[model samples]
Target: MLNDIVKNLLKEVSGIAEIPANAAFNIRNNSKSEGRHSTENIDIVPKEGGSGLDIYVKPFTKNENVHIPALITQDGVSEVVYNDFHIGEGAEIEIIAGCGIHNCGCDDSVHEGIHRFFLGKNSKVVYIEKHIGEGDGSGKRIINPQTHVEAEENAYIEMDTVQLKGVDSTKRVSSAKLGPGATIVIKEKIMTHGHQTAETSFDVSLDGAGSSAKLISRSVARDFSRQLFRSKIIGNTDCYGHSECDAIIMDNGVVAAEPEIIANHVDASLVHEAAIGKIAGDQLVKLMTLGLTEKEAEAQIINGFLK
Candidate 1:
């Protein structure tokens, strides 16, 4: 009975716009309302709910500019997914995708979120994704975002992600890809506390000649929280790739970091680096001597590390 209602709602939502060609989308809901969770896969379509800012994407055309801004709100146990972004050639586009999840007065509830993108040759794309959790309670939420970028020669892509705190939350994964003569840059930052767990993964492949990829990641874990990061750079042709993951663990926290670089062709150049350690005790002591509280000094160290 509940499934019938959700199906009806989705049917109404689908009536808002036509699906793009060469695109595929899928979303599933395990449970709804105050129960398990709800998940959906939605293509970039016109606004139908009169929210004016729900989901928006402008296609790239010759000498034309495009901007996409989307805001998603989850009041309870719900999941949302976005898949397959179709970008045209020689065009420029920007996307700002954000979500706010408040799981107040709920327990054992869940949320899942995903995003994917595909780019054409000689195109430029800038993407920003932010995930935030608020309210004081013991509920669970997971966020997983994946990006598939097919940039033609001379294409450029830049991606940034930020994850903020909520009780018992997890950041499942994040990833991207790059084509030949294509350039990609990725930056990720995360913070967690209060028995939370965060995990992030990125994989970038350079398949075109002279293509380049770069990734930088920073994270902070406190209390009984934990974090894990994995970054991989693969160069299959005459390409170059570099990746780095740096993290700081504080106060009984745990962190595991893995960074890998692979070059399958003789002309390929790749580099990978990772660092996981606690805040410097001497620095903390010096800050404390400067009349800062211990907690404040710790926060300063973490902020500096991420910078």
Candidate 2:
């Protein structure tokens, strides 16, 4: 049933084009099946080599939701890879990827995914990723994703991410070099409730002159949850880079944000900024005086802070 749903979703996105050929593709499940609602129940493995897969992925036409639960374990070293070729000038692509998990049982899950783009000169791409989990399941999940983007001169790439409510999640990320006169923008928003913990990090660099990079991040934590975000932008030669982080805290919640910007050349320019705070009590009180209940006022304050 999950496979059918994914295939239908992919078909809706594929539109009139023929399904890309799948070659040298494999899937393995070795762990005991966790309770229902596992992501491992549904998996789509892309072939090693593919053609006609260079087209852009537009944003979802409307709101979409995907929920699943699964337990996957790897005894020895294992890996998963995806490779694609995209060659187009003055093109644009927007993708929205999201997932929700209710339980993972006891088995640990590891996901290592890669995306490669052969962008043409003056092209633009925007990618958004979201992850959410629920319940009191006690299992570990690790996600390591690498994106290699070859942006030609005057090209642009924008990446955004949002992670909400997880028990124990760790994400490791990587990115490639940007071409001359290219620009890269990154924005992230994360929220955690309950006793969950999450750690995520990203590393990006501008390898060509006249390139520019920017990162903006916001995190909110409640209950006993802990969240950490580490981001770095490096400017080489005559490039420019800037990064900023903002966080909100509540009910013994803890959050740490680290933004690092480095300039390796005399002509390079870099900047880093970060802020951490809690919802203003006076603001909440003022709202409560306006006929709103305490719960409503607190929710409004948090919504405003995240915005």
Candidate 3:
């Protein structure tokens, strides 16, 4: 079953699913919420509706490399999880959250997650999330993720999201507000194939002096897949913001990259850049001449490009 597959993979990726754990983990198995455990200084409370979790970290606590895995496996099942996080001041933490979906039923399966984070002053938070979908079923496996972040003074927030393969469709949206001397960085990587489609939108506001944000996205569309990347960053104070979108399109695939920057203050600065193109023939030929097969060369190029 997908539960077993995902559990094993999660263990390999994050080291452990449970047992001797320091941080908390909540696993959603085919619309069913499973056990969750946490450390002493951390609080993990299940929401009233059983579809979400409320998490709080004590001030001055350092929680590093915390693994929280959520898995969804079932045909025709639709599961939604809401995670509300409040990180205390002077605390540094890392979170690993990934979703694996396996659908073998004729009906389409979907998972939509909403996550919100509140960063306290002088704190640093790193969040890593990965989504994977796989099955032999005729139905589509879909995942859509939405995130919101509010960073206080001197706070740092870094978000990494990756969608490797097998998802039929996705629409992702993320927004953040940065306070004075706060920094927010977002990195996204996605790959789509086989008639799939994906769209992503990011909105960021640097509202305080010395606040800054960077939004970067990399995607590959192949075999009739389509994708759209859009980001709009606004600087309202003496801040700096930048957004970049890059994509490699192949095999009749289509992609659109749109980046916009808005500066409201004279001292504020913003920059935007986007690029979408197919794989370079010369690069592929050179790799192939080095004793690599065409397919191997293509794979190597994509792996390096995404990395």
- Candidate topping TM-score: 3
TM-score of each: 0.75, 0.71, 0.95
Runs in model 2 lying further than 4 Å from the true structure: 1-45, 48-87, 104-106, 135-144
Indicate the residue-level lDDT of 225 in model 2: 82
lDDT of 1 by residue, 1-307 (tens): 2244333323332321222233222222333211111112223342233212122223454332222212222335544444346666666765544444444555544545455556777878787766655545555555555556667778888887777566366655655566668899988888888788887777777888899998888888888898888878888899888888888887888999887888899999888888888888899999999999999998788778766
lDDT of 3 by residue, 1-307 (tens): 2356666655643456443344566666666666667777678888888778888877787855555566656788887889888999988988777677777778898888899999999989999988888778998888898999999999999999998898899999999999999999999999999999999999999998999998889999999999999898999999999888889999989999878888889989998888899889999999999999999999999999889
Candidate 3: worst-modelled 10 consecutive residues by lDDT: 12-21
- Give the alpha carbon lDDT tens digit for every residue of 161-224 in model 2: 6665553554646465788899888787777777767676767778888998887878788888
TM-score between candidate 2 and the true structure = 0.71
Candidates in order have lDDT scores of 0.62, 0.58, 0.85
Rate residue 213 of model 3 by lDDT: 93
Q: Where's the lowest-lDDT run of ten residues in candidate 2?
A: 33-42
The true-structure Cα RMSD of candidate 2 reads 8.0
> Model 1: runs farther than 4 Å from truth?
1-76
After best superposition, candidate 3 residue 281: deviation in angstroms? 2.1
Question: For candidate 1, what is the TM-score?
Answer: 0.75
